[model samples]
Target: MKFLHSADWQLGKPFGRFDPDVRGALTEARFDAIDALGRAAAEHGAQHVIVAGDIFDTEGPEDRTIVQAISRMDRHACSWWLLPGNHDFARNGGLWDRVRQRAGDKIAILSEPEPRELEEQIWLLPAPLIHRHNLEDPTTLFEAMETPGARLRIGIAHGSIRDFGSSGETKNQIAPDRARLSNLDYLALGDWHGTLKVDARTWYSGTPETDRFQRDEPGGALVVEVHPDIAPTVTPIRTGRFQWLNRDWTVNDKAAFDAECDELLAKVDAPNTLLQLSLAGITSLGDRVAMLARLENDLGHRLRHLAVRPDDLVGRPREEDLAALSVEGMLGTAATKLNAKIDAGGPDGVIAKRALERLFVEYSREEQA
Candidate 1:
């Protein structure tokens, strides 16, 4: 039996960090991912698509959001098994009920811990969330749940595989050897927001669309195929409209930095890419100023979003840069004090560096005028 394993759709996410136009595009892309999953299912000849959890960004979404999701899923002929996640936990007459109202027979809400027959000799054991956070492991019940003639037992759940000593991993901690403990053929997981392989039989499908800046191979679904007594074959299929990338670079020269930026632009289709580039190392104040201008004026426009981190990127003032700021005037006097502060090197050095850059920029503008 073959099926698509996916999770963290997070439909109706406001994406409030972005502007109205970009936010709209991001929210729309999530709905579009449903169609992508449908197409992938068709291409793979898979009839069932199991979304482990988090179909919605919140438990109570707008009616229009609910309608949009149902309509898109209805377009596909195959079955879509959606399990409740932390964001959209199960309850009496809640979001899932509203979904059930609009959803066709093809849409199966796995809001309860039950084993449903997928096909001949195949069974899917879904452990759906009832609350936003659970103290006990959701998949613990899969151990006792029995399915008659269940040749392929695929457990679907939403939680962490282990406590990584992090605050985020505190809730919904599932055992690392859950697949083995449950005696299942495969285990599909969610809540990690990144594609991961827990063991030979367990895997996290990640989000179908890229959302956050952390690059964890976010844009994909795991197409899983299982046999009676064999390991499941999991293939990651990319299905994201936008790419969120984070990169770090160091600048020692202006021309080299420009060349590096050129290389990046050439490699990435900037129109569909969002990047947060953190720059470090040191360069001349003039070159640093020039690079900042190019990044803001030229590079920023090319990409969907460009966030430059210039905290560690120091701009050592050159004689020419100081000359441009004026050698014997009020501007020069202020520049000298700022330069002294920079040389002293303390908490105030950070502020002085920025002031020096602004002073140079404004003076250069006046000089040009």
Candidate 2:
């Protein structure tokens, strides 16, 4: 049986951290990625598509978001199995009901711990979230179930693997030994947001689209082709529209800053990429302003998302530099004091120092008027 496995769609999520326009595009791009998944399934002649979990970002998505999701699932008439993750649990008046109201027949809402037989030799065991947090091991139920004769047991769930220290002290912990214990042919997992192979039989399909600027591993889905008594082959498929790049650029001079900017701009596919540039190291205010202006004016239209983070820059300010600032009284004093505090306090104290620096900037601007 040929099946498409994917997870972590995160639809209707508010990308508030990004610029308003870019956030909108990023949210919409999720649906486009889902559409691409449906197209891939149709092209591959998949009998069923299994979404391990996290179909939506929230339990209560906007009506339009629900409509868009249903439309994409309907595009392929093949059976689509959806399991709810921690993000979209089966709470009262949740997205599951909305999905039922829209794509009832076309999709199977596996929002409970149950196994449904899809074909003569295919059984889908879904471990869905009853609440936002499930302390018990959901896979334990599947382990107790009697194996069907001449059938392919496929287990689906969303949680963290025990042995995989990818995330620390996070909820939804899945025992790594579950796949071996359950003796399932294929175990599709979610929540890690990266394609991983726990074992030959167990695998994490990961998020179909990229959402955050995590530098752990690239995000994508898995396509599994299973034949009875034969080893199931899994392939990674890239579905994300935008490439999320997170890099620390150490700027000590104009040449270094320019080179770093060039490197970042080169990474972008332009108009289709989201970039988070974190500036580090010491540089003059003149160089900082020049780089910021260049990024805002020159490459602003080329990139979909751009953010300037100067929190990491640290250096001792020359007294002569402060004297030539033309600011007087508390504003200048605060700027000098804040810079000193930032340098002495180290990286952990930079955020508080930045707050004081902003106040100083505001005071200086008001005094000039």
Best candidate, TM-score-wise?
1
lDDT of 2 by residue, 316-336 (tens): 334644664436666567666
Question: TM-score per candidate, in order?
Answer: 0.95, 0.82
How well does candidate 1 match the true structure in TM-score terms? 0.95
- As a whole number from 0 to 100, the lDDT of residue 347 in candidate 2 is 65
- Alpha-carbon error at 278 in model 2, in Å? 1.8
Tens digits of per-residue lDDT for model 1, 119-208: 877888999999888999999999999888878899999988876454242288899899999999999998877788998899989899
lDDT for every model? Answer: 0.88, 0.76
**In lDDT terms, which candidate is top?**
1
